[model samples]
Target: MYDEKRACPRVVFHAEARLAGADQFFDGSMEDLSRRGIFVATAQELAVNDVVRITVLNTPILDLEAKVVRCTDRGIGLQFDGALYN
Candidate 1:
């Protein structure tokens, strides 16, 4: 199998996140994170390319808007909108 190449920086951390537009909250650990993206594993399934708002643990005041890049049976990979950070 061919390995996918990543262009962004990734940092691992244990964090709590919630999906936007959904009232139900999920407890998941952050697999990786960067200023431009994040990867998280949760029980709920999220659609790829879906726009979502996520709040990281200990950073409640900073809600991030991101687009789903990949979705698996257990988790989601999100790409943050560059415009949101500027």
Candidate 2:
């Protein structure tokens, strides 16, 4: 059984997303969102501990800074530098 170790609950949220890293850019979509992090579905390659700027397209939200925490064949998991608040 897998353990749910997340500090915050995640909600199903689909949104077009852009990831910007040093000399790297990826177009992806967010599958789930939480106050502390998000999971982005993308084929683009990224490494753990990489810093990236995230922008949710067509939204009023400002750009967010995050760090890559987990990577899988399906997507990458990111932890925001700060909690996402309204």
Candidate 3:
């Protein structure tokens, strides 16, 4: 299956991810990655379209802003402007 809202194809990836809001924080991992977005495996519930800063632990891309696109039982889909931290 392909993501219709994605600009690039998604790839299966495994990376540490942290989502931080103004008053909340979630610790999770990035389950997959695309050019413009990623699927963050977070257990905590986040509202759709909510903006969050993503920090890939120990990576260069710190505090990347992303909009929540989809929130499922497993995780949340994030749309960002740039690449996912490698």
The prediction achieving the highest lDDT against the true structure is 2
lDDT of 3 by residue, 1-86 (tens): 95477557788888897889779988988977887898998788988889999888868876788999999999999999566554
Cα TM-score per model? 0.73, 0.88, 0.80
Native-to-model Cα distance after best TM-score fit, residue 6 in candidate 2, in Å: 2.9
- If candidate 3 were superposed on the true structure by all CA atoms, what would the RMSD be? 3.5
lDDT of 1 by residue, 1-86 (tens): 95647665566767777667345555566777776788889767777877877777777487777888998887888888883343
Supply candidate 2's per-residue lDDT for 9: 81
Model 2 residue pairs with clashes: none
lDDT of each candidate versus the true structure: 0.73, 0.92, 0.84
lDDT of 2 by residue, 1-86 (tens): 96778779898999998889999888998978999999999998899999999989999986999999999999899999988984
Question: Which stretches in model 2 have alpha-carbon errors above 4 Å?
Answer: 1-5
Among these predictions, the greatest TM-score belongs to: 2
Q: What is the TM-score of candidate 1?
A: 0.73
Ranking by lDDT: 2, 3, 1
RMSD versus native structure for model 2 = 2.5
Please give the ranking of all candidate structures by TM-score, highest first, separated by commas: 2, 3, 1
Clash-forming residue pairs, model 1: none
